[model samples]
Target: MQETPFCLTFGHILPYSMSDSNTTDFTNPSTFILLGIPGLEKAHVWISIPFCAMYAIAVLGNFTILFIVMIEKSLHGPMYYFLCMLAVTDLVLSTSILPKMLSIFWFNSREINFSACLTQMYFIHCFSGMESGIFLAMALDRYVAICDPLRHSTILTNSVVCKIGLAVVLRGSILVLPFPFLVRRWPYCRTNIIPHSFCEHMAVVKLACSDIRVSSYYSLSVAFCLISLDVFFITVSYIQILRAIFSLRRRDARLKTFGTCGSHLCVILAFYIPILFSFLTHRFGQNVALHFHVLMANAYLLVPPMINPIIYGVRTKQIRDKLLRLFTDKGT
Candidate 1:
């Protein structure tokens, strides 16, 4: 419910405190206090339960992927290498937010210090950028495998694959690490109340007392460079893949190509679509389009990790058989 400003009366003849005219102070407070849980403060318990459950599932799913990929020697190929890297990134991504988010949802005192906010923001960007790079690696791997099947082994050497993985991690970290520094230099108005569950870069930046133009530009630059490069590279890889598949005489080869690429395409759409939606909504729509934005936020993080294992488990016979045996035998 909306609350009215307080009023005072002196024997039915009241005067507004001239100092209550301090609207400027309220607007430019030293700290932006978050008055959280607007309508359903009483429903916090119910909210907490589901939030905890979802987060638990996210953690477990990603962790399980990492475990299975590591344990099975048959899965030590390039595809599963990328898959495991992605699982690692997924775990980091979810962990960066979920524990703190769970804390806020379950209990009160949702105060996050400036340092903590910056830490969370930095890691979130780092892991996300890494995911993008790994996706590009995956695309490149598929491209080489499909388009150059004669010498796929020689071209995509284990050493070469190791270098590719290293470069992806390094480049991603380099691209995103500067963002936190740019943000930290600003003299924030001490508003700790993040509009979202975690300290999103733009949301936190928007709360700065100083002009965020430079920071915003940096953010936009990173997004444009990483995402555009990822999309362009993926598209180029897939186009070549298509050409290669068409050159084949057998119909099954085309079906095989479609099956392999289709899953990657689905995962790509799952990630980038929600991310782009969030970027646009947060930047342009203000508070108006937030419901969808929030949904997208959850989708971007959870869906990839949740669906990825299923994809591999269903499609890759060895993984399916291994999972079955592992579950059935529970090694004594």
Candidate 2:
């Protein structure tokens, strides 16, 4: 008699047949099983509490940022426009992963259709690239505003901002367009069980029967090229900005100028540090715990979106003041 196939569910082994009509194929799965943090299976419910809270905060905060930016005409500038773009990108990025993640954790719905997995992977990566580009644009906005204050208005007009936004979108979309296609072509003749809560590209690719060097190399190249170039440009822009700020005659002017960059700096650190850590962990941390890598990956998506609005709201004088007045009027 043929042995029955089994799968792990909430720390219990259950008979899971691959031959069932509704089930995924063993050779080339039509659906993949997400393990939802392998070692921490029993704690998925507890884990999801914080994840759910973060998702809620991300949604509410990003929408709030969008609403504030839209209503406050005074914020109709290059920096705020880039911020709105960032907010939208964060929303998409977090939303792409969190809902399904929660479903897996809370309901034990580990099965994700193949095409849907690719869609999730695409959105997550695409918006992540877009976020990076937006950060570069925002850095440039600050650079121009501080270094060439006189021409700031002329240099980053509404038309120019729109074009920059378009460029960011196009660059991200075009580059990431290949990822799903590449992954789809791979033969997943290995197991369909992915030890992750979401369809992370490498996680899915690892299950392919064929050699994944092309997919791996492509992903690494894209990440390195995008991040390295963006970081270099942002560094250059900030160096110029710092020079301009220090060259100012008045100490108060320097302080005020630096203050303008504080929120952006915080946001940049919040976004990049976790993501870089997660990337390195995924690529090189072979001995690292699987749960650690999974947690970090989720954190990069969740933490930034949740904190970005708070960073802007608290650090930006105009936004803070506007929020206060809006709430105060409501309280009356």
Candidate 3:
């Protein structure tokens, strides 16, 4: 959305207007402006280059993972099943924001319809929550495999993995479905200039003329309840996995066990560190530059999708070998 100097609010007189309450009729605007990046207006042209590159890599990388896992019979298991789900979620999350963001940078098309914005907001949050859930599932997969190797196959069968994937999607969608409706019901009297790249929940909620305590609290509650819970379980799983590794009598076996977790640990850090930073910076970093906060917010969205495949490709021998063989076969 394009930024404007002024916006009209209901039941309030326009400054320097001669008309009184009897003469004024308030009309709610049909569209909102997404201010792409605060204070980086001049660099938008340069910014789009790297943004486009990252988007391209994220799509290609994630798609490769999905393709390999789907066709390679060797990789058909609970772990790879969850990885495939992660690739899908990353694709959705990246696609949800990057194209519109690019439009703003390239064509200066910043106007998004109110309904469209809410839809975008819903998908962004839902996909993110789903990714978090998928991470938790991966953690559980690793926990069962390492901590209880004998029962791993029995515990997480193909049917069970499918059920877990379906449950993750449904849980995320159900929890995030209310966010758009909550924002849509509010009367937006302030400037609809969202000071970030996308229709992030809090940024959009802050524009409401009415008290936003309910929406704010609800959003915070969901973040903590869902994201935090996912992180907690993942941490617990890793801890148990570590304990299991240490209990191994053979050094080679211990290293191999830790090696199995290496890729996941890289991915877990890549996904969560930026998220935690963005969450804290958005809430408590008033003294920090708004543009920096906005940049970090964009980073949180963009970085994980871009890096996940790289981490997997490098650290995951099956994926790495498949990628090499695929390319080599193509070359020959």
Quote each prediction's TM-score.
0.83, 0.92, 0.91
**For candidate 2, what is the TM-score?**
0.92
Where does candidate 1 stray beyond 4 Å? 1-50, 330-332
lDDT of each: 0.69, 0.86, 0.83
Q: Write the per-residue lDDT of candidate 2 for residues 15-64, one digit (tens) a residue.
A: 23343443433445678888788778889899999998998998998898
Model 2: residues with Cα > 4 Å off, grouped in runs: 1-27
lDDT of 1 at 301: 67
Which of the numbered candidates is closest to the native, going by highest TM-score?
Answer: 2
Model 2, residue 318: displacement in angstroms? Answer: 0.8
Q: Model 1: which residue pairs collide?
A: 32-191
Model 3 lDDT per residue over 1-332, tens place: 32222223111322222224312332354776776876677798899999899989999999999999988999999999899899988989989999999998898888788889999999989998999999899999999999898999999999999999999999899999999988888776536666677888888877666777788788998998789999999999999999999999999999999999998888889888888998998787756776787788788788889999989889999999988999999999
